[model samples]
Target: MSRPHSVVSQVPSGVLVVDKAPDMTSHDVVAIARRALGTKKIGHCGTLDPMATGLLMLVVERATKIQDLLMSEDKEYEGTLTLGVTTSTQDRQGEPLEEKEVRSFAPEEIDAAFGVFKGEFEQIPPMVSAIKKDGVPLYKLARKGQEVARDPRPVHVTKYEIRDIALPEVTFSVDCSKGFYVRTYAHDIGQHLGCGAHLSALRRVRSGKFTLERAVTIDMLKTAPREDLYKAMISLAEISLMRGA
Candidate 1:
């Protein structure tokens, strides 16, 4: 027998807010949200590594229109840097290539180190990233043990504040325009300090006007009913109006 009309009519449409968990890629979240909503019109604004967590913006059905605008917006993150170690990837996932005994620094010294990174500057993205080169992803080439020169692109770090100066870790907040690579920023700063550093943990707190405050965990999203799924997704026009205004 054919399905009831009420069932077809009951599907709601909107945006979904996901508090991405550590170790789960952003694409994994989209797949789960797609199955949860029972529709194919689900998409995410930007990519986040599996090691990172916090705000991961998603759109459902009509809301998918907003992804472009959201992708171009400023981002805010709280991250921790591991000193005395340098990694190939500039993040904890990579193998450590060098280790040095680090000298602990005062808050003022930490601030000064990052002050050089703030404002507009050119940045070269790490090889183990999604950025493409000559029609192939750089990460693909990197995995094959090949290296290539990458042009530095201009990026702006509006705010780079040292929030804590714990012995081995430096916790901080970084606010930047679109296209900024916090990983490269950390690596270069480490090089400048003469102790080397790598990103240990990162959590995106804000993207444009959408904050982690409104994000729900993946588990919570997985348990939500199909009809309720689309109801949670917000539209691009809505985000544009909210962020642009």
Candidate 2:
């Protein structure tokens, strides 16, 4: 006869808000959480690019059921775009493809160009993205020196504001619907400005009702007491409340 599982091995069902560090993939966070929490029943609501950092919602145990619903919610991000440079990946990770002189522009000019991006528009998903083509992720093909034609995807940019600008670099925030790619947005803006551009940095600050303020870092999970770690978990009941919010 086999022995039943112990209570110590079974963690409570809930969501864990994580402050994902730069260079770590979403799956990397999930693997670390599995070991820290002592359970393999862990999953994430959305995938963040390795170069992007910030709030990542992880569903643990029975909380995994709501992953799809959570992923479908709108998201907010803040990042800096570097003007006068274009990259193959649309971000700093890729090799520089082109460079142009950064020309002077008024704040109003920048705002007017951004205004054109507001509301609904069609965007081509970046080749460095996880979007699949022919059963393989586009990034895989990108790594092999391959480029494929992709259809433009409709994306809604509810808000796009330039917070600050220092010539070659522009810092901005965006509130956009799911499936929107901020890297593509930056690329498009650069094209409109006639100077080219690429995403230099990105941080996801919000997802659905969850925010980075409530997230815990990997270091915290590693050093906190087991009881304290449990305290950080958001129960599924709490998540259900967000459905109406």
Among all candidates shown, the one with the greatest lDDT: 2
User: Candidate 2 residues 113-164, lDDT tens each?
Assistant: 7888999999999998889998999999999999999999998989987999
Highest TM-score model number: 2
Give the residue spans of candidate 2 off by over 4 A.
1-9
lDDT of 1 by residue, 1-245 (tens): 22122244444445577889999899999998776666788798778888989888887777666578668989998899888899989999999999999886776777788998988899988998888999999999999988899998999988877888886788889999888777788888888788999999999988888887667778767775554554555655566577664
TM-scores, one per candidate = 0.91, 0.94
Give Cα-based local distance difference scores for all models: 0.81, 0.89
User: Residue 213's C-alpha lDDT in candidate 1?
Assistant: 66
lDDT of 1 at 40: 81
State model 1's lDDT.
0.81
